[model samples]
Target: MKFLIVEDEESLRKSIAQYLAAAGNICDWASNYDQAYQKISIYSYDCILLDLTLPDGDGILLLKYLKKLNKNDGVLVISARNSLNQKIEGLSLGADDYLIKPFHLSELYARIMAIVRRRNYNGNNVVKYNELEIDTSNKEVKVNERLVYLTKKEFDLLLYFVSNKNKVISKSAAVEHIWGDDADMADSLDFIYTHIKNVRKKLTEAGCKEYFHSVYGVGYKFTDR
Candidate 1:
């Protein structure tokens, strides 16, 4: 998953980003309202960790923008505000969930996963196709009841392909999804082919059917037919 951390406190922001990154999620950070605005306006994220107060303005304004565009990206508001009205307004404005400050990072992880599952997968923590299964909660993939050990990138890759099955995913998009802001610094999309090749080989070796197909000029598609 790709997450955008909208926070003003440098230490906390880095801490949160680091924790999520360690958990195998790509993360991007924005320190103030304008920075956050620019990121949300341009990039897509699986979730956003929004702080209610910022150096420039209230974070609710960001929520308002998301509502104006009718964006369904999961939002887990991280705020120090304990007022009832504040929490109420955040949720009413489209935040999927709210976490008070000084909370555990583990709890935040759980909440983010819950919201992602609810919004993106209809509350499904497990996703499967035929004998291939993904336990999102554990970040594990299985084929024919046998465990498939995949590197973090490979696991993320498999989830991306499974989620968008039957659709052609461009290499650039896939790169951005996996690497987040670092994708901009990348010289080329060639590295993606290597990862795809590895994933293809692993699944094939695990007794899975060929579901990933390469599109000559565009990118690749994962489909059953």
Candidate 2:
């Protein structure tokens, strides 16, 4: 998973990012409203860990921007303010969940996962598309009840595709989602082709129907038809 930590506190942001990264997620962060806005406007993320208070603007403004753009990115507000009115406003503005400050990193991770699952997989740990099934919790894929073994990267890629089924997943989007910060150091996007080829071959060999389609001049689209 790829996440954006929109937080102001350096210690808390680093703590969250470090924990999530160790758990196989690509984590990036923003220390204030402007930085967060810049990242969100250009890139996509599976989830956003938002802080209600920022240096320049209210976090709710960012939430409204996301809504105005019709973006489906999941958001979990982590703020020092825990008043009923603040909670209600955040939730009403489209936050998936709220976490009070000075909480354990483990619980925060769990909340992020819940938001991701609910946002992408309809709140289920398992995802299904006809004969194809994915046990997200275990990172397992099966076709017609037969197991399909995939590398960590392959599994993540497949999960990404399934989660955003039938959508045009741009090359940039795929690279960012999978590589996160490492994407900047990489020279080119040619590696994306290699991964896609490998995923297609593995799924086909496993007797799964082909669902990936190349969109010329755009990106790849995963669809049943």
Best by lDDT: 1
Worst ten-residue run, lDDT, model 2? 175-184
Q: For candidate 1, lDDT tens digit of each residue in 1-225? A: 999999999999999989998888899999999999999987778999999899998899999998887876889999999999999999999999999999999999999999999886779999989889999879898999889999999999889889788989999989988889999999999999999999989998999898899999999999988
Question: What's each prediction's TM-score?
Answer: 0.92, 0.94
For candidate 1, list the clashing residue pairs, or say none.
Answer: none
Q: What shift in Å separates residue 9 of candidate 1 from its native position after superposition?
A: 0.6
Q: Which whole-number lDDT from 0 to 100 does residue 74 have in model 1?
A: 89
For residue 16, give model 2's deviation from the true position in Å.
0.8
- Model 2 TM-score is 0.94
Per-residue C-alpha lDDT of model 2 across residues 1-225, encoded as one tens digit per residue: 889999998988999989998888889899999999999898888999999899998999999888887888999999999799999988998899999998999999889989988888889999999888999888899999899989888888988998888899988888888888788888888789899999899888989899999999888999999
TM-score of 1: 0.92
